[model samples]
Each structure stands twice: as C-alpha cells, then as structure tokens.
Target: MNQTRRKRRPDPSLSRLDSLSPEMLFPAKSPSLTSSRIRYIFLLLTFCFIIYIIFSYGTTFRREQISSIARSLSVFSTRRRHLLFSIAASHDSWLRRSSYVRLWYSPESTRAVVFLDRGGLESDLTLPPVIVSKDVSRFPYNFPGGLRSAIRVARVVKETVDLGDKDVRWFVFGDDDTVFFVDNLVTVLSKYDHRKWYYVGSNSEFYDQNVRYSFDMAFGGGGFAISASLAKVLAKVLDSCLMRYSHMYGSDSRIFSCVAELGVTLTHEPGFHQIDVRGNIFGLLCAHPLSPLVSLHHLDAVDPFFPKRNRTESVAHLIGAASFDSARILQQSVCYDSLNTVTVSVVWGYAVQVYEGNKLLPDLLTLQKTFSTWRRGSGVQSNYMFSTREYPRDPCGRPLVFFLDSVGSDGTEGTWSNYNLHRVGNCHRAEAVERLERVRVLSRKLKHDVEQMVAPRRQCCDISSPYNKSMVINIRQCMPDELIAMNT
Candidate 1:
C-alpha cells in the first residue's frame, strides 16, 4: 500500500485509450485546403460562362454576315423592306371601278393605307379602317379646290411620325391612280441612307403653278419618298410651318416649303413618270430613262402598258425588261417625235415609221433607229457607224432602209455593206453619227452598272436586308440568278 505494495503494471490497451487526446481523434481543418477547393469550383463556372457567350455571339455574327451577302447580291430583297405606302383616296373613289379593283390587286395594297375624307369611314361597312383629316387638329386649316387636300399632308406626316417604326425607312405618298413598282422602289431606296433627311421624287412642268409654287416641288400624283428622319422632323415642325405656306397651290408645294426650312432638297429621279396626258403609255414605258422604272401615274386616264394583254401577260412582259434592261428595250422599240405626235409601234422588235416635214428628210430626229453589226473577223467589231455614215436623199424623201437583223455569207450579222449603196446627205449622216456615239457611250455605262448590280463582289454587309412580298417578286423577276444563289 502506500503502502509499499508495488502497483500492478497497467494493461497496455487500457493505457493507450486513456492517453488519447481530442486533437488526435479529430484533426483541425487547414485554411489552404479549403481555399484550393473554392478556387477549382470558381474556375469551372467561369469556363462554362465563356462557352455560352461564344456560342451566342458566334451565331449572331454568322447570321448577320450571311444576310449581308444576300442583300449585296440581289437588287431586290425578299424581305418586305423600306417603304410604307400612303395612298390618297376619296370615299367614293375607293370602291370605284378605276380605283378599288386595281388597288386591291396591287402588291402595294397590303403595305398601303388609304387616307380618306371626313365621314369616309362610315361610307362602306365592309371597308378597312382608314385615316381621316378631321381628327388631326394640329394643323387645322382648309383652303378651296385642290388646295384643300394639302391639309392631309401635314396630318399624314404627323401620324406616320407618331407610328415610328424604325424599319420603315421611307414614307411614300401617292394618289390612288399611281401604279407602283414596289421592287423598283426598294431598289431606288437602297441607293440612299434614311438616317439623312431626303425628299425623293420627280417634278411636273405641265401646270403653270408648278414653277410658281416652287420648282423643286414633287408632284404627289407621281408619288414621293420622305426619308424617315426627314419625315420625323416634318411631323414635329410641319404643323408650325403650315400657316406660312397656306397660300401654296397644292400639297406638294406645301411639303416642299416645309422641307426647305430643314435644308432638305428634292432628289429628282426620272423613272417616276407623271404622265399627265390621257392616252396610251406604251411609248413612254418603252422609252423610259436610265433609272429603274419606279411608278406610272395617271393610270386611270391612260390605257394599260399592254392594252391587248391581260394582267399576267402584261406583267410578265414588263417585269424582266422593266427591272433589268429597260433602257435596252427602250432603245430598240421606242420611236417618238419631239412633239410626241408621231410614234412607231414596234411589235416583236420590228416596225417602220414614216415622218414628213414641209421639205425633205427632217434634221430633227427625236427617236432615231439604232442598228448594229459585227465585222467577219474582228472581235466585237461594229458596222453601225458605216451604215449610218451616209443617207441617200430622194426628191420625194423615199429612203428604203433595212431596220433589223441581217446576216452575210461570212457568218457576220449586221454588216454595213449589206444595206445602203447610195451616198447623199452629210447633215443627216453627221447628226446620226453623233447621236449613235452618245447612245453607245450610255449603253456601255449602263451595261457596266447592271453587271456590277447583278454580280457584285462579296464584301462586308453595307446595306440593310429587308423583305416584302412585292420586293421578293420583283427581285425574282429582275435578278433571278442572285436570288437563286442566295437561297442555295
């Protein structure tokens, strides 16, 4: 015992258990280990986020690039792009034989909204919602006769601005009689930027008041394009400017006056024809200027472009030639005097015209006939100058001439030697040569331009790619090759 009894040796297992500490059973956590695990998790999440961004951005870039390519290749776009047609129609005229029938069937109908007079909404229960003048209290002033229509101009500008769809780059205004080449319209608009204010249309000098109001005023009957930015500016300030131009002759003049304040000038495009005369427009369309044929106004007064043909036939005939090679057809088929009193009808590219002045062959050749032939061996050789170099003068002014295609034994077509044997008048020949040279230069330039438009180099997206049904049809009609390639 304390005895001095020696303590028994402790059991080894019991001793070990008793000696164990809390620190040995459960180890303390390391700060570095916890931080390493957190770092691994953060890296994984960042990698996933980066992958998502790449996928999204890559898809968008590819799509944008493809669309740009498509637009650049074709003259007309498939997307209903660029124009908002504002049609001016009277309540009585909307359902009339001359207006509604043509308007309903037109490609512009869907994009167009008819602006009618007060109480016009109630006239026909079947009609769609139309804009009326009475509602626009902003520019509330009226005048007599045709001038009363000017009030609607301010209202249309205001309402269209209020609508404010950025996609609508142009605000096109026209009378009900106007026949639009919607495809040509988009093609024309593609040439300009809508961000800058622009007033695009043609002028009319048939009326005395046209020059009196402003020489720059665009004839509304022929239709006009107001750039979206310019339209917005007009919407805001037009009401204020109306009072100053109250005495203006027509809506076109009023609009001209308003835009002039903002330093916007008219961009005259001759393709838009205001054919004020009442007759057949076959001659006019055939001889249309170098620009894309935009519209033919006063259709109600004139016979259709192809009077004998129906809608389908006439459209087919006009579509391709009108969009791509209008100038070529014009040069070949159209023959008219300066007074427009004498016109030749060239059917299937063959016709003959006999003009008479007081004396012999007249020097005034308004629409001269063009003929071309290549030399047998020379590449791209033309005998046009030789054939037109001399003209035999008859006392009775009877000069029998071959008009079209002729071939020689040497496999050369249109050789100058095959036609005229006699040499006579110098003045007429010199005049003809000068005219031919001018036409030749114009033709070369046109061909170059058309080639550039149809098969342009693949470049970065410069213009917008918008679509419309009408535009699609036009593009198909005009530039089928590009359209096919784009889809493929």
Candidate 2:
C-alpha cells in the first residue's frame, strides 16, 4: 500500500555507483580530465612532428653529402669534351695555317672557335668555326715594334669566355700554325683540377725570347690552357689589364701579365713546345722530354719535320702515326744492345737512331743543335732553354737516322711502326748498324691513368738482333728498379 513507504531495499550496484565520482562514472564526457588528456596528446604529437622534421632534414643533408662525394671521386674525369680551344689567327695566315688546324681539330669531338682578324670565306666544314674578333682599337698598344694585333689576340681569352659554352673545364689558346696533339692534350689537362686556377704551358725554347718577355710567360704560339674557373674571372678584368700592359711585346706577354695580376703563375708543362729555333727540328724531336708531346708551333718557320716531304706533307705524315698512338708519339725510349756495343733511341711514332757505340742516356737526352738559333746572333741570343750538344757538321759522322714510314695496329693493344733509314750519305757505319735498313717498333698503346700522369717514369725497351735488314724493338712499362742504362 504505501508505494512511498516502499523503501525498496537499496540495490548494491546503485549504491556503489552513487558513491563513485562523476568523472569515474561518466568517463567519456568528463570535463575535468579533458584538458590534461588533450595536453598530453598535444605534447606527444608535437614530439613526433619534431622528430619527423629533424629526421627528414638530416636524411636530405646526408644524401647530398654522399652525392657530392661520389661526384668528386667517381664522375669528375677530364675528357676532350671538357676543353674549349680558342685559336688566334689572321685572315692572311688562316689559309696557310688551317692545314695544321685540320690535322688536330675534329668538329665532332673537338670544340674550338677560330678568332680571325676579319671574316673570310672559311666554308670548309672540316675546320673549326671562324669568328671575327671584336675591334680592339679602343685598347692602346705602345710596344716599340709590336703589332697592334697583340691587343686583339690577348682579348681572345675574354672573347672565348663570352661564348657561354656550357660544361667547359679548360680554355686552350694557340696560334693558327700551332699543331695540337689533342689526345695528349686531354691527358695532360686531366692531371689538374679544373675547379682551381691554372696557367699551364711552356716558355720559348730560345733563351733570349724568355728573357725579353718572361720566363713565366706561356708562349701563345706554343699554346696554353687556362682553367675555366680562372678564365671567367680573368675575362672580367682583362681589359684593365691590357690597358696597363700596353708596352708588352706580344699577345702572350699581355695574357701573362694579366694572369700574374690575378696571382696565377705559369704551370710549366714541358710538352708545349715553343719551337723558337729555325731549320731542322730532328734533334729536338728525337730527344723529346719524358712527357706527352702536346703541341708543335712555328712549323712554317722551320724546315719540314721530315726530309724529302713538303711542310704540309710532313705534318700529315706525323699525324698519320699520331693517329695510331698519340701518347707514344715522339716519346723517346732508349735501349742498348750490350752484345753488339750498340745503343738505340726510338722516338716512337717518329724516328729511330741507331748508334755504333754505346751512348750515355744523359748524352742522348741532350738536344743536338741540328737547328740554328731562333735569331741570327752569337752568345746569349743563341742560347736555348734545353741542354744542347753540337750536331756533327758532317752527316756521315751522325748516327744512322730512320724516319717513320708506316704504322699499323696489331689489333690487340699493340702497334707496329716501321721506320725507314733516312740515307744522308755513304757514311762508314759499323757493319751491324749499316745492315739495318728499318726499325720495327712493337708497343702497346699508351694509356696513362692519373697516377701514371702525375708521377711519370720513362718506359723501358728491349732490343732484338737485326734480321732481314730489320731490327725489332719492344717498348713496355719499366720494371721496378729497372735502369735505362747500357748494363740494364
């Protein structure tokens, strides 16, 4: 009867629930704990985000560093594509000298621009593209007897840089008559880092010329190379440099003065020959320095490189052998025949000299003065940069000389070069030496790595007894501790 009085027995579950806190009872919508829970979640999310950002950035930086290292160590090889040739020439000389350019310049592989004083009908597709140099009349030239063209020629460095060629590493400059052994040039240039400033070339062979100009100057006729990085900086400041060096004698002197201002000195690469001497260069070519033959200049001023051939023919002849093994071209390899008391000097791809008696290596290295001084003078003016021994006046007294006749690749890494005896006269030669009419040189194609190029050692040669009027000589890498002497 009394629903109101029906104090229902207190349910244990209801009592327990009634005694619990609201936060515990209604857990999902509890406001008191919401703020702290949100704060904890926010802190956790922030920490994760920070870690993610740091990891992402660190990963990118590490990847970039590794990529840079790989590029430097693996992909930074210097090749022909890295070189840009800037040939200085006049309209008058280009016609005659273009032959020399043709010998080395390859349109498909070699990048070059010939800066002529004026544009001519240079329609030959085989030659390098010709561009007329900008007017240099604004610059002053005060050298007493020097041509004003020196200013124009010196500006070729700037002009070449303005060309905006992409991926260039070096800018090589030379006279029109300069004949480049392009393959060897690439090898020599690969020895240096293109990212740094380098002025690589050699001085004139004539002592007086070096004194008059500078021992540090790179004779333009011989050719020189400027690293692209330095060339760009030099281009911006060359005009001011030219104005200051107006009294300089030649274009090379102007370039040298400008480079000196930039704190760059000549890195003498003995391979670039400023053949300042006139007449026969047989002696010079026979005793080439223990380096790759890079270039030859003043061909027109000197006699034909080979006797009985015209100048162009002789150069083509040399290039013919160069096409086979450019690194070995004109490389001197001395080997002695101890049993016969004979010494043989093989100018690979060029000539061979067979001597009757054993000649000292140092003596063979000295250039014979077969050519006259650059200038007709006595004493200091006649001096040369290299050591010289008097070339016998009589041809009969000289060693039996043989010139390159033909060369062929053996299809394996080796080549065979046949050198025919260059008969001077009926000289009294040792029967053994007289019997040989040809020299057959067997050698592998020279492939120099960076280490070999940096620390080059002369190659060793082995000589065989003469047979059938022919002598066989094999050229190979020198063994450890091997000596290039009579006894060795």
Candidate 2 overall lDDT versus native: 0.89
Residues 1-488 of candidate 2: C-alpha lDDT, one tens digit per residue: 65556567877798688678646754655446676776676699899999888777767797999898976863347889889999999999998789889988898999999999988563889999899999999999898987999999999999999999999999999999999999899889887888889999999999988888899999999999999989999999999999998988888998999999999999999999999999999899988987899999999989998878999899999988999888889989999999888999999888999888889999999999889888874554568888899999998888988999999998888899999998987788777776789889999999888787778888989998755499999999888988899874
In model 2, which residue pairs have backbone atoms overlapping below 3 Å?
none
The TM-scores of all predictions, comma-separated, are: 0.51, 0.86
Off by over 4 Å in 2: 1-57, 74-76, 378-380, 466-468
Choose the strongest candidate by lDDT. 2
Cα displacement (angstroms), candidate 2, residue 19, comes to 47
Question: What is the TM-score of candidate 1?
Answer: 0.51
The global C-alpha lDDT for each of the candidates, from Candidate 1 onward, is 0.49, 0.89
In model 1, pairs of residues that clash are 1-4, 1-5, 78-467, 79-466, 79-467, 79-468, 80-467, 80-468, 81-467
**For model 1, the run of ten residues with the poorest summed lDDT:** 467-476
